[model samples]
Target: MLVHVRSDGVNAKYNEELATECLVWINQVTGGSVNTAGDMDNFYEVLKDGTLLCQLVNSIQSGIVKKVNNSKMAFKCMENINAFLEAARQLGVPAQETFQTVDLWERQNLNSVVICLQSLGRKAGNYGKPSIGPKEAEKNERVFSEEKLKAGQTIIGLQMGSNKGANQSGINFGNTRHM
Candidate 1:
């Protein structure tokens, strides 16, 4: 969860806070037996040779073994699930459908929650990588133009659409009959 964002100009400490919040939420939802400090060590141990889903299933099974069934735990689980989804959203991870499906307090829904967390984790891992910034894009464009020039080709940029067509400005096509 130690993400360096130098290339993207993101606040690494803030991202760490978000990651910690996500971990705490997962810990609470899983009754403190998954995604905790110790649990993550075990997770990494399994992750070296196994897939994410396998790691998730193993972690969830261990958590279930240690879970205490109670109304308070149930309530906290749901609250933490919501908080986790919110944190993931704030971190630019998409989990809307997964959240909607796994928000319930059914045991069968645990797999969906695991899947969502896996997806968020994967996206978070990639979040720190460099992107095509404006400067980089301009450089690429210049290089492409140079390549085209070297190949004796002229880049002809064309705009194919016009506003004078049947779909006029401010016209509502839905209001017309299809006769």
Candidate 2:
């Protein structure tokens, strides 16, 4: 049977820890522009405008975000976020690892913002930049030979009822009835 589990939201404690870690990393990448040494508590508010995010992505890989909007106007700020995300994408950060503009702008899911930053950090090493958080995931794409593919097609998988000649010939289901 399938069951549905309700999720309230992200872990506040984990978000706090990750936000701190990302702040320190952003400071390191931005060369103290983020100020983790003193303003550690206001991680979200500090980055809510998306300027730091643009700076962070540019640090990871140069020339990605051509221009970061310094304006505090909401749409302009969201444009900064979009630029950062696009730069992260160019840096090979998967889209799934990034958050939407609303997630960061409206603070709907700060954890996702942290996650996206961590992803960008992980990808930093690819561009010979300083990195933080978990190491970036490696791509291990497998290629099969045509002969191997043909051989696989000829074989019946065990889950497909081969099971050493076992069969369900005698099985019976309940008779149809309106009870």
Candidate 3:
């Protein structure tokens, strides 16, 4: 791959490595049909139609996509991508983690697509499915009794700062600009 100086440089360093991991994970989950996604262009070609993406999501949870369009029509392929994204969201992937249809279909910002797949992998792991990325982001929901809530109201929040030794004299900003 030729280096393009005027590109999104942030992910340029690790995008290839991360994309490779995503491709491996997708193949593992979807029965290994994808042959090669060694680079961004190849990755786009492999997933541009969205069939494999939908299949991987379906394998994670049956019928999440409802349907996967296999036609070559432009609309059909974009729909497939949309379907896959909806399914991924149903599987607990965050909305921000999914890429727009144009990103893959128009071959723009494919790195976002790679990130989406990586997020899907983590979400799949959370649901006890096969995953490829780091550990799933677990929710830590806390429950507080009424007493605890009342105690919290009495205590000053750290954001408000401590006012134990308050004074009337505060630094005035130019004496309030009196005429």
Candidate 4:
């Protein structure tokens, strides 16, 4: 019993209120450091980028193909559908069944995108937990590691020089004495 919001008549005041609330929540969760002053404006500018929407569409299309042709492939398709639905739910979009036909799923996905955009716009600030503190770099210790440079083994083709210029008469390279 998921309630679907119509995208055709989205309320501007509602969106603005949701966006402001989302910003406040984001500030609360992330300590107001995740986004710069104008980042939210930039986000609203690119909200309709359609990258994720296109990915969802492709997943649905592929799943539909698999469902019609091969049962094994269809299982993979179902997994894709389930993943999309789960992600949508996590983003506050309503439930959409994988059992539905591809056409229905496509329409539902489109609706889900609109819903997700609205929900995200409203709750973006509240999504993630604040960092406790800076994380320490991991140190790995290994026994019997391979030797990088063995003793008494000089790298070849390297030039060595003395500041006294006494060795300038001779072309001395590295530890090798060239006479």
Off by over 4 Å in 2: 1-14, 37-41, 137-179
Off by over 4 Å in 4: 1-13, 31-43, 46-93, 96-179
TM-score of each: 0.31, 0.68, 0.72, 0.24
- TM-score, candidate 3, is 0.72
Q: Which candidate is the best by lDDT?
A: 3
Predicted candidate 3 versus true structure: per-residue lDDT over 48-98, tens digit per residue: 898999899888887888878989898999999999988888887789988
Better of 2 and 3 by TM-score: 3
Model 2 weakest lDDT span, ten residues long? 1-10
Model 4, range 91-168, lDDT digits (tens) per residue?
Answer: 444444222323223332233333443443332223333312223235697655346545325554335544554645
For each of the candidates, the C-alpha root-mean-square deviation to the true structure, in angstroms, is 17.9, 8.5, 5.4, 21.0
What's the lDDT for residue 103 in model 3?
Answer: 79
lDDT of 4: 0.37
Backbone clashes for every candidate come to 0, 0, 0, 4
Question: All models: lDDT?
Answer: 0.39, 0.77, 0.80, 0.37
> How far is 144's C-alpha from truth in model 2 (Å)?
9.6
- Kindly list the per-residue Cα lDDT of model 2 for residues 1-179, writing each as its tens digit: 22222246542423566777888888888786654522223765788788988888877767789998999998999999899888888887788998899877775667777888888888888878788877856889999999999999998887786556778997778985568
- Candidate 1 C-alpha lDDT tens digits along 1-179: 34222333222112333334445544543344444332323333322221222222224333312332223454555554454455556544564535442323332233334445545554443444221212211233434576667675453335645445575567675667768
Name the candidate, 1 or 2, with the larger TM-score value. Answer: 2
After superposing candidate 3, which stretches have Cα over 4 Å from the reference? 1-14, 142-179
